[model samples]
Target: MAPYQFIERPTPFNSKGGSTLPIFAVTPAHIETGTIDPIALDWAKKAGYKAESGSLLLIPTEEGHLGGALFGLGTNPSEQPYITGKLARTLPAGDWHIETAPLTANRLSLGFGLGSYRFDRYKSEKSSAPTLMIPRDADGADIKRQLAGVFLARDLINTPTNDMGPNELEAAFRGLAAHYKAEINVVSGDDLRQNFPLVHTVGRASADAPRLLELRWGKKGHRKITLVGKGVCFDTGGLDIKPASSMLLMKKDMGGAANVMGLALMIMDAKLKVDLRVIIPVVENSISANAFRPGDIYRSRKGLTVQIDNTDAEGRLILADALAYADEDAPDLLIDMATLTGAARVALGPDLPPFFTDDVELAQDLTEASLETDDPLWRLPLYGGYEKDIRAKFADITNAPAGGMAGAITAALFLKRFVSNTTSWAHFDIYGWAPSERPHSPGGGEAQAIRALYHHIRQSVR
Candidate 1:
């Protein structure tokens, strides 16, 4: 897909007349009051603009050329933030500019730019969509940084499993490393067994060798921030195999990895003050004679023995090794994301992801960040009492419990065992896929907790 074109205006108040399409804002009550601009009101009235929020109006100027559109934002000016995204989609296929509006410069710029995202990689005729020009007063650098990360995540998730396996994921990480001049280290095949045994065990069955990809950036003296993501490129449920119906959309099992990379890109691009470490355990959970069985036991990097209660719970297995490796450094902050359990979706649905952390202060910060960014997350208990369910008579712990009463909590608890050294650690069991399309979010590989996390990390390290 071609790179997104973002236009920067010289000044917020100066209206550059290069755009072919113009969008005018209107309110429902404005039509009744007749107090709006006479020229705009007349044009709107002629175009049958009722001024219902989210409704679009297109008018033809006196010239033969096509006129601009009229968008309805709600009565409250503060609600205008929601309109930019809607405008991105409602506008005609031509260059557009916000000539006049009540929106703040930053909100107007970022919302419109983000909403304009569309994955057209496989499309025969690409979308010649109009570009949105940012006002001079707007934070163009920040807006572009955020959008770049988001588009990167969407592109990765939209890709099929055949083209985005373990090796492909490593290549993608390597590209990011080369771009940022970060040091990249990958332990795969035999090295994985020697260093990250649990990661090797789960991915040993697939043709693509399972590996742990680590990228280190920033100065060593800065505060350490570690990110762990489960990169199950494709999940066939291993020996416990998923049915054909369940296997559909399995390509999205790597959403966690995509999201972490998205957040990493944002941090690196912004040059946040922190020592960053990103660990992704790339694996393909496929069926084979060598596939780990339910009764199999594997020793983790931290030397904890984990008994496999279910082959389908391979995500936590790979994450176990990555988390152990991350904990070894004793980072100031640690976060791991995975589509680990179905119970999280059952509890919070697809829109809201559930996060678990033992630190109250960290939890509060994340909750506030979620509310501020409109990317909300619900806090689920680590529930130390539930640890008994994961106890293995022969091993230190079991990957899964017998009864699936608290699947999400148990999984979080399982990961918590591998993160004892970090002062502040959080785990997010994200669904990663949007079940349906919304105003700004599409149905495919959606990014969960990225905005909130970015905000939280920025504030925490500062």
Candidate 2:
């Protein structure tokens, strides 16, 4: 599918000979007066604008060309900005500009540009949706950079698992590296056994060989940021196995890898001043004679022995090795993401992911970013008390506990053992799929924490 065209300038008066739509911000007070002041007042009056949030009004222009649109945002002194994602599907195809508002030009541009995304990859019949044009004064480069990352993540996640296997994921990473002139290295098959034993064990059963994909960019001597993602391309629970119903959406098991790549795209596109390193262990946990069995013990890259209490708990095994490798460099910051546990969803639901971190200030920054971006995340405690669940009698730790309580916390504890060197580390346990369609999000592979993480890193690190 062709990528959507995004521009970042002041609102254009003409959009390829199509009608130009002016979007105005409205309030309850303005609705009573039947006028939006700066735009057309009479049209708003006739439309019965009540200034209720998300209300949109379209008025015909004096010329035969398409007219403008007025969106209602309830009046509150500190009301959040960019609450109009639903506009993506509602707005008619044409150029649009914010005519009246106090929002920062950057925020306004980003809000509209992001709202325009649609996953039309597999649509047999093409969509005739009209493209929205940016204003002349908007920051085009930044808008394009952000949208590119978002669309990249959406496209990768939207593709079904049958086509997006472990090998295919590696190809996507290499493709991105080639596009940006970044260096790429991949360790697979026998090489993985020698170097990334845990990663190999988790992915050995599938016909596709498991691999560790690495991409490095930027010059030496810069502050380093290492990203680790659990790339279980398709998990069928290995020998432990999942019921057919439970495994239906297993294709999205690699959501963590998709998100990291999305963030990487944003950082590189914007030329953020940091040496970025991305490590993903791409594997498929399918059932076969070669698949690792429950109760099997494997030595990890960190030299800690891990007992596989349940083959279904395979995400952490791959991440354990990748996290160990990431910690070896002791980067300035280490972040790992995965669709790890259902317990997280039980605690915070699907919309809000739980993040684990030891740094108070970093947690505060992430919280603020989540509020600002409307991408909510709740901080989950590392809870030192839960550490005992991961300890193994014979090995350093066990991948899963025989008892099922605190599944998410135990999983986090398992990954925590591998991340000792980094001073500030954050782990996000995300449910990558959206069960139902909403305004900005369609029901497929959703980018759970991408926006919040992007904002936090850009503000704090860069």
Candidate 3:
């Protein structure tokens, strides 16, 4: 097996070992009070720097070389904690350190590291971005671990389907498992069809065989935390093909898997005390003569027959089999993530992914962690009211329900059916792609919900 080109190299934070310029993050209040360096303040005044949030201004030395810089925090600086991230793009290529900032050292450093990401694997001219020296008070190792996980997910998601299909995804999975020295088992072909029927059905159309990939790590006696991600490498919506516009970004259909892989990296790197299991049902929902069609019914691994009301609803079918298989383990926590519904995007937009879980403590902890880590997550109800919608006339359940109301909820509910054995289970319907650039994230395959989950898990282990 030759080295897969798509498995990205780890992009870590820079150490504070060399010459670095200072960056002072100033606010309008600071300028008004004249608390900043007088020379720099006067220069900012001459430059008409308004201290607008996310704005940057570079100072010059009398010798005409790079000097200190100013970053604007605006009035309510705390409103956007990752505001310093923009500096990674705007700063000249050199080592830099924060002299003063409204945000904590951890946030400022983390933001810069995240903004420094570049997915230029295919480009002839690779990106060259400035680096920030890790703050002495910040957890540099933890930040590096987080960035490594995020970069892994982003790279996997950003890769085109030609380089990231089921086979490639399996290779990446195997690579990650090998890196961590974890135990991995993959089921495909006849075994997958016989045992995980729904996963096989949704994926049968692709040239590459569909696979159920599982990775187990950590000591057996630790708390069991099992994660399942929908690995639809490419979704042409099966026989119910998507329009050209909808198909453009389908390479990111495996975002859920990417994210969990990243989160798993964080957990494994941190050496968190937990038994971790990752389940990825890998497939490419393509158009072929054998592609599962609308109205097709297939029995799942859990013995529940699923009626495919729409072939585009293939993610849930694969997840159904994976979740059922995971449920049998009765892990302390069971989580499934997927790019499952457009309705979630319509409801919450892209930045904030909606998570569904009935566990109160888990929701509260995740809410706290989201705020702490700045990983945006909103909890949507697993509303029992919509339970009747997924019921099918002939099969046990319909992969897609009619009247498209609360589609995200209905999808969560549909996945919930196979998860009865697990006491604590959560589902995240993630957009997984940043439509445009943001403070800490660029416009490409994004990692959603994992940071909060990582912090939540860390706290749980403690």
Candidate 1: tens digits of C-alpha lDDT, residues 1-462 = 332221221221223457446667667677767766666678888777887767877767778467776777767756546457767676766667776677777777777766676766677887555567777888788777777777777767778887788888888888887888899998899778888998899899999999999999998889899999999999999998899999898888998998999899889988999899999999999889899998888899999999988899999999988998899899998999898899999998998999999899999999999888777799999998998998998899998798889999999989988988897999999988877766565568788898889988888767
Greater TM-score among 2 and 3 belongs to 3
TM-score of each: 0.93, 0.91, 0.97
lDDT accuracy of residue 21 in candidate 3: 88
lDDT of 2 by residue, 1-462 (tens): 332222222221234423445677667767676556544677776766666766777777677555777777778513646555545557776556667655566665666555566665577885544355555676777767776777677667777777788767888898888777889999998798867999999988889999999999977787788888889988899888899999888888899998889888888777777899999999999988888998789999999999988999999999999999999999988999999999999998988899999989889989999988777799999989989888998888999876888888889988999999998999999988788865455567877787887777787655
Best by lDDT: 3
**What is the overall TM-score of model 1 with all chains considered together?**
0.93
Model 1 poorest ten-residue lDDT run: 5-14
Task: Please give the lDDT score at residue 360 for candidate 3.
Answer: 95
Ranking of predictions according to lDDT: 3, 1, 2
Error of 1 at 46 (Å): 3.5
Q: After superposing candidate 3 on the true structure, give the runs of residues whose Cα lies further than 4 Å from its correct spot.
A: 1-12, 16-18
The clash numbers for all candidates, in the given order, read 0, 8, 0
